[model samples]
Target: MSDRSQLDESGSSAGEAPAVPEWLRRARWVWLGAMLLGLLASVVQLADRETLVAEIRERSPELSQQEVDAATNSGILFTLLVSALTLMVVLLLTNRMLQGVNWARLVLTAWAGFEVFAMFITAIGLAVLGRGTIEQLAGQSVSAVELLAQVLVTALEIAAIVLMFRPEVNEYFRRMRPRLRRR
Candidate 1:
């Protein structure tokens, strides 16, 4: 077929010039996946903390009813709020960044890296600190499922970071970056 035949009605070639690099496309998915992963981690954290509070109550029956209820309800409420906020921010950032928003990319990168660090520490605590408390846990040692979830979440965050820093991916942001005002 002739080139003219491939042209759009406006006469521009159908093979348009705004070609997105494969790496950037992959990065978008990676970033989106990271946001989902972070949200998932937040959910799991909320649930685990709730379970911990329940276990605490079971282990300490003598604790005043008011005390147990107060702590348990407050902990869950705070965690839910935080988790919901985290989920919203992550999804928002991911969506904006993929759309070539420079500020959004920066925010997501910073947040994801910091979150990974936080998850790493939490994972270590679950894997090690729980071991110390195993006796108190009375055979309810932290299980493989919990450990794996932590590891998976950590790995997902790392993947997101790696994708963000990919040469083509970073270049996309560089191209979209706004000029800074001179001092």
Candidate 2:
């Protein structure tokens, strides 16, 4: 076919940008929701420091009150910094993904996979060590809000991943692929 004849209705030739599909837009919002939920969970977890101290004490009866207090303080600061950094990374990647960067989409998929894998490993370890059930974990180290947020985050991530790979989204990405190569 002639190059001009091959142009899409958008009046742009091949390798030119096309309008983003609706499914990709929905996927971006869904991914944003997951990131927000994760941020909320991290904040809630840090707020309940007494429970953190108690959990630490239960695991190590030998640690003095002073040591536990020190550890809790440091741990809270570390967790907060990590959470903020993670949030920044998520925002950057999501922006790139929406711009039709295929690598960004793959990175997000890998992230979700790693999160699910880590959760599975933690659950198995807890069960094998007879640590306690989800209810018990909530009562001890984790707050109800945090646990709920985590579950919702995981669900949303999975939903967003599915949406990202829809037929229309795939076509959009395919159209964008040539543009990427030229750059």
Candidate 3:
């Protein structure tokens, strides 16, 4: 039989249906939740323009008023651009993950791994330098809501990674692989 004849209407061959497990479906929603939390955190940070400018000024005390203003404007613009790009990436990856794309899962897992590693490094640096040094450098404390949101986002990311690796999800990916190759 021809390869084209083997594929059903849904694009899977014969008996294979692109059936996503409940865990993967839940993982997709968790990813969406994480994305929303991230957006909230970004918005909260962006909303405090005065504080952001004050921190920038504090760090660069020697800068003239005009220079500081210019820097603040540029910084806000950069932040907004980055936030928009991040949102787009999160949406794209979440959609692909829902479609049983193994590469998307791996990419997201790698991103989470990098975030964990960066957190570890920051913690170690803070521990080595002590709280006083950290406070001096940071110039301000993170709000409780922001901290909670960050924690929730991190937990959701870890949960999604774990869910994507479940036996049924893994099997689904495996079954989809050959079909993808044929196309």
Which candidate number has the best lDDT? Answer: 2
Pairs that collide in candidate 2 are none
For model 3, residues 142-166, the per-residue Cα lDDT tens digits are 5656656766788888898898899
* Model 3 bad stretches (over 4 Å): 1-16, 123-129, 135-145
Span of 10 residues, lowest total lDDT, candidate 2: 134-143
Winner by TM-score = 3
Q: All candidates' lDDT scores?
A: 0.63, 0.81, 0.77
* TM-scores, all models, native as reference: 0.60, 0.78, 0.79
Candidate 1: tens digits of C-alpha lDDT, residues 75-137: 668867876786677777776676667677678677767767877776566578665575354
Worst 10 residues of 3 by lDDT: 8-17
Clashing pairs in 1: none
Clashes per model (N, Cα, C within 3 A):
0, 0, 0
Model 2, total clashes: 0
Where does model 2 exceed 4 Å of error?
Answer: 1-6, 9-16, 60-66, 119-145
Query: What is candidate 1's local distance difference test score?
Result: 0.63
Task: Return the lDDT, model 1, position 18.
Answer: 27
